[model samples]
Target: MAATIIDVARRAGLSTATVSRALRGLPNVSESARARVQQAAEELSYTVSPIASQLSSGRTGAVGVVLPFVNRWFFGQVVSGIDSVLRANDMDLLLYNLGDTRVHERFFERMPVRRRVDALIVLTLPLSEDETRALSSLAVPVAVLGEPTPPFWNVRIDNSVAAATAVRHLVNLGHRRIGLITGAAHDPRRFATPILRRDAYRTALEAAGIRYDPRLEAMGHFGIEEGAAAMAQLLTLPEPPTAVFAESDEMAFGALRTLRRMRLRCPEDVSVIGFDDHETAHLMDLTTIAQPVVEQGALLARLVLKALAGSHEEPSDTVLPTRLVVRGTTGVARRDAAPGVPPSPGAATDNGTGARGARSPVP
Candidate 1:
């Protein structure tokens, strides 16, 4: 029913191969031939088949986007960005969501993407040695959106610096007793974010001459319920922290909900800060570190496309900027100090240097 390459070639008075090359804008096709092929195609209302194009070019014209969880906010935003670019470039996206250890292991073992996609964009998915080897052996160009992994094009923010900046914000607010709620370190898909944040929290305290109190730390598993539970446990401690920091906006929301249930006035009783300037963070009035989550996805997708087009070479990582965003949730330490000890002295100032700071689930 539709015109094929043969029809276009005959109509344009050129060979089929010439017509194909001309339509695709491949080298060696003269401008006159390309124009003739275009005119013929338009006259016949003909469109090239994507499958046939791939077969001829030896390219899938598709990208494999691998993420640990797609339903999470960060991943969803990232996916949206990637999808936008892929769509504009006339390419398809084959998403791979490794929601559990079994699924993750199976995907890596099979490495099916090698045969189905032209390039890969891995979003904060940590790889074991074997997995890394498998990915490298796939011979597909890979782009990562997280911490830098050698031999792969990457886009990321410095987690350590971002976390330190967050903690420093609280410190500048005259809060000496700071507590942290972090994700579980032992999770199968665990990456360096939580660990790096936790370490930076301690480092921030040390820099301010505050003692590192292990009792002030709680593991929230990066969930709302877990954050609430962790906050509840912290509240039960002998001397609760004056301020708390959740590693993600979701966790911070959970912590804030728990504080409300306990009739604790934010900033007046316990100042709370979180990472990721999630859309809801403003609604919650949460003070947080904002990272360009969606932009990272867009950048990685661009790199993937470039590599697939045989344009990107000399592997390099793109480190994005981050910034602290102060809001109503965080403030100066409560004035109700102990009988003798004075509250740490500092004005409550938003320390966001307009520089920057998730891999939290979306829902």
Candidate 2:
């Protein structure tokens, strides 16, 4: 039969309560008793029951992560970061993926995570007033990754600034006719990130003294296949754009694929840039606005821990920084390169940095 606390207490020559307190590292147990309990536990291979420990402490020993899409690369990276911190702290993770509308609605209606986790981490999902109230009623620490929800800890990057930097990069490369592939147009949930990015794209164009043409904007809906279709649609325009800025690297990958299928050379024909310097962006030589994806998640987890520990008094917002990563996918626009035609092989490949060398891959 497996060893239990009783066996450990008997072998240690101490009361069961003393053995339990020593094993749990609770105060009031002397060093001698703790050593004896440790030796006895090792000798009998005895371990405390996690269920019993949780019941006694009234803590589930888990953090709940609620996100819209678990399958997306960005979300996966964030979750990995969150899990790393939580795991190191001896805590478990419970994921709630509200990808489907029905599931999202049901989650708020049922409030399943109530009393099931010590804290909650919410990712970029726009919450309604009622839904926000429902989450608040859980009475646990909540940290959000996007916009600041008053009374909740928040961590995020400035979407408007990062997105504007991407469009401005293309404009500085001498591209007048720029296209935008955005996810906001088709999102039923009205996620704040996509909307902010799309608006920034328009504002950047105006700042560059360029007219904002709706025809140059396509609905990518934040998916690879959707991005490809959106790129194809832009190519069908009467006067297609000389460069394209995709709101996500996954969508940028699709745009690159479409360019390849059409036998059009990147930068030489249609320069491309993306947001979120995803892991594969370097492999694809994509220029993008790099946000600290994993670090944001780790920060959110740390904030939740601080709140749970009673160290964090008031709700706080932490906005991480973002930078532009230049790579081979974006370069100086060829003035004579027309739609459906690639520039001459000897055309300048300057990446708008005034340097005339091979573009180095982004790490």
Cα lDDT of model 1 by residue, 1-363, tens digit = 889899999999999999988877799988888999999999999998888889888888889999988777778989998999999998899999999889999998888798788999898888888887888998988998888888889899988899999999988988888899997666867777888889999999999999988999998988889899998888887788878989998889889888777766676567899998988999888999999988888888889888877784877988999999998888776445652122333223232443210111111
Tens-digit lDDT string for candidate 2 (1-363): 999999999999999999989988899999999999999999998888997898778899999999999999999999999999999899999999998789999999999999899999999988999988988999999999999987789999999999999999998988888999998556678899988999999999999999999999998988899899999999888788889999999899999888777766687778899989998889999999999999999999988998888785888889999999999888777655564344443445554466653422321
Query: For model 2, what is the error of residue 296's alpha carbon versus the real structure, in angstroms, after optimal superposition?
Result: 0.9
Off by over 4 Å in 1: 3-44, 339-363
Tally clashes: model 2. 0
Q: How close is candidate 2 to the true structure, as a TM-score?
A: 0.89
Residue-level error in angstroms, candidate 1, position 177: 2.0
Candidate 2 lDDT score at position 242: 83
Q: Highest lDDT, which number?
A: 2
